[model samples]
Target: MTKEQLCEYRELQKEIKRLQARIEKLKDKNEGYVADVVKGSSIEFPYTQHPILIEGFDAEKKQASISRFKELLSKRVEKSMNRSIEIAEFICNIESVKIRTIFEYRYYDLMTWQQIAYKIGVTDESYPRRIHDKFFEDSPN
Candidate 1:
């Protein structure tokens, strides 16, 4: 696997988290609509029509909007999750132990170079980076 493809895992994870947050926000807004309906806050008169009927109309529109947005966010989350799984599998399949460790620590786990060095029993943080660069340099593109 190329360095660029492996490096994309961190950003995909971030996007998944962001999309999940948006889904949660949509859920919260839907709940607020329910609460507002329960509290009769949206009640208004067409004089000839029941307040309940009017409220239902407004609530349905808001509910549809929120549902559509939540559905879109959910799809985005699924796509990111699938890409993350592919990257993780690629990282796991690398034959070199140290190189795999560097990829996992740097990309999958999102660890700093210093932390990776410590984990791999090296004194210098740059050690991991050097190994990574050298591996890619020697690898066939």
Candidate 2:
């Protein structure tokens, strides 16, 4: 992939992970969920045309509708993930282990640069970042 394409690597990883999580939540929602239901209480009036038809909303039907909606949402997330995987894979194919680790920790692990510097045994915060930036800046177009 072109360096320009690789520029989007970090964002793609972040988006892919976010989409994956949403997909999982949607799947879980499809299973089922609890909902608050107010007790059915109908008021009777002397001059009413007919007695209040006091039947609470159908929980079964409501839950089913919610599940279907979640299923639809899951499909959308899956489609987004499909597009994201290509960029994520391209980023992962980077030859340098350190660069890969930087992306993984920064994007996937969601760690600060200070944290990454510490994990990688770099004393200077800018050292890791400089190397990362240099890799991209010096890439042959």
Candidate 3:
């Protein structure tokens, strides 16, 4: 991958991490609803807890918001993965399959360039780095 593409990949990776944390928070918030702990007297309202919402807790509205947040999380994850795959595919589009493998290992699998070189059958770890550099230099505008 080009240096610009690599930067984009890392940015997307960070965004995914941030979004996953949000998803986790939403999941935790949704899971906090337990019928046993709810405050309700039988003589007042006995069906579903609606009028007597817990302070700062609107069960139905909060659940809907959580569900929407989950949907957003799914889309963001898919978008990041898809874009990364597209970049990887572009990196692989050269005549050599090894470049594609190297890019995938580096970006997708989070492997060191040296590890990629080793996996790609290069005796010298720096050889793959040089080849990728040449590839970047030779790329068209």
Candidate 4:
């Protein structure tokens, strides 16, 4: 795989993390809405709590919002999984063990060059990075 293509894996990982945070925020907001709904139902006049909401409309909007969020999360997770698999397959297909290890450590395991160097028994972090750079240099861009 080209360096640019392989680099996309890291970007995708970040996007998934961002999406997770957003989903968590949405869940917290949804919980607040649920609590409000429950509290309003217990009162003799529920409209006092939500003066602007029409009967049943607020609940329907909440449900639709939840369903849409779930669908978006599902599709993003699936895309991330597929991208991970593609990256794995590309790394696996490489002929050189050292090159493959570099790819796995850097992309799959999300290790720093220093950590990867230590894992491969090298003293300098530059060793692994140089190897990675050289490999990309030699390969077709």
Candidate 5:
């Protein structure tokens, strides 16, 4: 590969690493939030009554709800990553390096398919359908 191509590859690698770190940080935060909710409830329930028992219960409930939301976000992130990996592997197998890059940038990085198509010198109207077709073609029945 040319020097410019090598530099671009390094930049893309850095971007992917940064995104992975963000995903990890979000997952860790989600776990910590869940833990806080559990700990707060455990301390407040079935034991010596604190003065602000009702307030503690309310706080615990709110925390629990927030923790649930965080859990959902974490799960969605994991699902997205898994789907991207599957798509990337399929594209790689097809020997379509450019399309694989476009797919990763659009799906994994959360850019629109239209944006990806434009970047790859295509029109927006058929971009999503094309990608969808490629994905299903590669997917197991």
Candidate 6:
């Protein structure tokens, strides 16, 4: 084969490898989401024992404050979930299924742009940027 043909073959192989890696990453993300759904809420970090020699704060008051903090956190989580569902529905309405999935996985699932590009079978990192531009182009500013 000519040098040009060999170079093209190598490039094609690289692209295929990149696409395979991206698919694996996306599959892993989907598995994680499925596991989370099956498992319900994840375990929280255990509270550590407070130092015996502390400042002048009351122990009861501290415990009360911690409980209140946890309640606030739970509310925030609920609010965020609701907002995410709203955004996902909006994307579903406007974009193609593939682009919508990429948007949801990247922003809602908190995956990196590279990860999203991989899932969509794109070898280039710039694919995520292009997807974002396309999404926004049809969206109201």
Best-fitting candidate, scored by lDDT: 1
Model 5: per-residue lDDT, tens digit, 1-141?
Answer: 222332344345455566566655653343323222222323655865433322123456556665676576566556555654555555466456665676556544656667777777878747754765665567564
lDDT of 6 at 128: 79
**Which of 1 and 6 is the better model by lDDT?**
1
lDDT per residue for candidate 6 within 1-141, as digits (tens), equals 122332343344445455455544542332212111122332465644332432343546555655565466555555544544555556566547777677667544667778888877888978876867765666555
Candidate 2: deviation at residue 19, Å?
7.5
C-alpha lDDT of residue 74 in model 3: 84
RMSD of each: 6.5, 6.9, 6.8, 6.4, 13.4, 20.8
lDDT of 1 at 95: 92
In model 2, how large is the Cα lDDT of residue 113?
80
- The candidate with the higher lDDT, 4 or 6, is 4
The global C-alpha lDDT for each of the candidates, from Candidate 1 onward, is: 0.81, 0.66, 0.74, 0.80, 0.54, 0.54
lDDT of 5 at 11: 47
Q: Which portions of model 6 show Cα errors greater than 4 Å?
A: 1-71
Residue pairs clashing, model 2: none
Considering lDDT, which of the candidate structures 1 and 3 is the better prediction for this target?
A: 1
Displacement of residue 132 (Cα, Å) in model 6 is 1.4
Rank order (by TM-score, best first): 1, 4, 3, 2, 6, 5
When summed lDDT is taken over every stretch of 10 residues in candidate 4, the lowest stretch is 31-40
Model 5, 114: alpha-carbon shift in Å? 1.4
Q: Cα deviation of 110 in candidate 2 (Å)?
A: 0.9
Could you tell me the lDDT of residue 137 within candidate 2?
79
Measured with C-alpha atoms, the lDDT of residue 50 in candidate 1 is 25
